[model samples]
Target: MKNRNVILTGAGTVIPWGAPSTDKLTDILRQDSIFINDKGEPIGEYLYSLLKTQMGKRRAYNTPNFESILHFIELLFEYKKSRYSMSSSFFRINDFFLIDPEIQNKLEIYESQKLDKRLDTSFGTKRLIANEYYYYELYLHFTFLIKKEIEKYETVEEKYHELNKSFNRFLHQVKGENGIVRFYTLNYDYLVPKISNLKFFDGYDEKTGKMNVKKIIEDDYIDCYYHLHGSFKLNFIGEKSNDYSVCYVQKNFVQNNLIPSNIITGYNKPERILNETFYEFYQKMIEDLIKANKIYIIGYSFNDMHVNAALKRALKKGSAKITVVDKCSLEDFHLKYDKIIDSNPDYDMNKLIKFPNTYQMTTEALKAKAYLNGLNDFLDNLIRSNN
Candidate 1:
């Protein structure tokens, strides 16, 4: 009778050796490093060079910082797919034409046509090409950098296979009427679905080649993967341009002949969560969590204000038991939640019945608590018996 919903955050929470995946992203971030030169002064030469090469005759936007540039790119993609339509064919086409290189060249030509006169002229064309080249080059560099760093650890592929084995073992041993494993992740990475062997709820019928609202139940196993922060790979209509959307480089672009780089960074915006398509996805995930008997939080800092609010809302609707798997001590964890709880005056900390059901421990400790002998065995036995 134990229904567990596992939520895992990325970054600092899932560190293997005191380093998060973001560490590998530094090279890409610093590729166009904007800092002072060796003379203890701003590197005007580099900035000017980039401006000349990338901006051309186009009037610069009010915000010229790298953050703005990145945000602009992200927004451009967001504006394109305003409809939030979902079609496998569209997905495949975008992946091939917009994501992969073979088709990206064609997309670039198409995109060029839509540019304003300022951006469509010879100078603009040259700047666009240069900017595109720079962007893609940086992307490839980052990909390789991450790949190299990943190689240092056990291969994600290998880890995924191992995790699968563990999951299968857990499922086989834990018998119940509800054979559902609810998974929530803060990672922008797509490792969970790849490992879990789960597919999006597209409601596609292979035999008829038609879309249907009826759910497809594959086998007796059902694993639900929920993305807490928007997925890095999920394609969204861009905010800047109306012609294109953001997509995954590998799945949507590389395999399909579309571009192989993400156009946006800094995806933790409140507005993004409320996007029509994303809102539905979030609602479905919340519903699943609410129906669960127990909640497992892993690899999350619980610092994201929006996510924390959402979790609190969900908790308010349900009376499920909660367990936090983190590196911090119980007192520290309580203090962290205390801030969240204190923010809402309606919820009194002393009378908060939900807090008693919460538990915290490190991943290693949690694993030990569930498997090891002596104290671990006693704890696991007690928990299982109580449940």
Candidate 2:
């Protein structure tokens, strides 16, 4: 019997490849940003306040989330241009935008503390933002920072291979298998290709290098390799991409820009995941999850609700065996995910709590084998256990 296998890797997998952890990335973004408006006004005070913890609180007091902050910034870039509805005069966008609302009221009512401070203090910032020029600059900086970090995947040290012994063994097993194998990732880097020497189609046309998503989705026997999140290489270049373009463009050639770095980050992922080629990959993931006999998860946090929903749907069926490889102990991993799933009452994903397929990576297994700390830790435990 062929053992059909599905694998899902996350940003944690790219940590070995020199990608910054979320907290570190947050720090880098905070430390480096100029926080000055396009019109020469200093907005650093309020901008940093939004990032800081309760004005005087320590790092433990809810360290500001990089994803949430970036998402809020994206929202600010969009809703700053609020206007009276031309269609319906009674319904003003300002009603939704809170035109100069009190800071305390905003703090009490809105999750985005940065929004009102941004609107209240910085008139120049608000004006420049309303005109759409400042938004582009902010977007460019954030995207560029992310791009720089992921690009370091090429420069990662060879020593990290010590942490990858289990995966290497898994890959060797895969090499000998006649079973259907699928690989998917939530990372925005090309590390997948670097690790897996297998040739796989990723919806992009081989000759034109442009993606034909519809055609690829229609094909039945295409290699089930996909990037669940978009990648740095997958830019959509066109005049249409100008409105929210975060493309790498010359100062002179801004008009001829790619519409946003295709690498999906921050928030609003369910909607963003449907963009262009990712839609096909998303569909493929669902299909693979449903049909898979065994699933191997590497370095994923099950944090994405959209993805978790799909995974929960699959888990509810109680079929696929699961093996997770991460730096964390299985108990800690369960708690981390339990906190996420328990909080979300809308989706009952508690099925994952006792899924009965956590194959030999648990703390008990560690005790039986040896100390397995992280990806950079010794491979002795994993190698001996597998043998």
Candidate 3:
């Protein structure tokens, strides 16, 4: 028996209160304020206070840097509400040639300057991109706040706190078994590492609290975490400023050369799958999933084509049974599993599938097994005494 457990969790498993779906985030953008909860109370007061504490206790209302950041978030939220009002899914027109005429007019010179379409004239594609950037930027901001708040928990007992405890406990379990847990997150925030209290290593040394992959694999004692798309922590490129430090937060500064990491959204994700860093993490996740005896997925919507493709490949390559833990209906979950099964002609259903309810049954079986084993031992002793 492969007595090892490998868990793959999405943003839902991390964020306590927020619905872990992109549609739910769109609902927040449609709200009056991102800070206000569904009850209309400013639930974001704590977030504001934390930022204020970091920026300066004395900085007056609406300073240029402070106000600008808030304005960017507001603009993004409003834009998503306006653009995605009628559509169930957001669309990003990434085709440079299919850009809006107005944007093309402004960048006509750069458009003319490009010698070839393959020469990477991305400046012209800015207008083609959707309003989703604001939504993502706002998300990163909120996630950072959430991470800071969760870190304050010395002992968690609340329902919301359970998510953090679950992650912490799961990581420790994997470590105890001398197993490596690879986290490939779609989130731009550093919440997983912050919550797991692990180091960030992306196979290179940029001195940004990151480590090398060689050291990670050679050492059986350490767990590895990777940002599949990218992260805001890698925003400043090679700036080497410990942005997590309170001093950096107080400065409210962003470098001029800040690339802000590559955040993929909507249908443009597949294009990023080939990126050097992104591919590295994605390949490693597939490799681990194929090697695992059992895989537990929490809060991940099996929606992304690129991710689903990798998952299907991994399922076909290995004999691992999967348990999806989420609020989706059994039929909905089975529909996703069916797609994976269809990929393999000789798929064995009995050995490859399970659900959340099955997990409960397994726990019960363990208790029953213990009792039965004890009863058998007692019966043997009684028979020996009778003889």
Candidate that would win on TM-score: 2
- In Å, residue 316's CA in model 2 sits off its true spot by 1.2
CA RMSD per model (angstroms):
14.1, 9.4, 15.7
Off by over 4 Å in 3: 1-5, 15-21, 31-163, 174-176, 197-206, 209-221, 236-260, 343-387
Q: Which ten-residue region of model 3 has the weakest summed lDDT?
A: 366-375
RMSD of 2: 9.4
- TM-score for each candidate, following the candidate numbering: 0.48, 0.69, 0.50
lDDT score for candidate 1 against the true structure: 0.39
Q: Sorted on lDDT, highest at the top, how do the candidates line up?
A: 2, 3, 1
Could you tell me which residue pairs clash in candidate 3? none
Clashes of 3: 0
lDDT of 3 at 377: 30
User: CA lDDT, every prediction?
Assistant: 0.39, 0.54, 0.43
Candidate 3 global CA lDDT score: 0.43
Q: Give the TM-score of candidate 2.
A: 0.69
How do all the candidates rank in terms of TM-score, highest first?
2, 3, 1
Candidate 2: tens digits of C-alpha lDDT, residues 32-64: 434443433333234445545342343342445
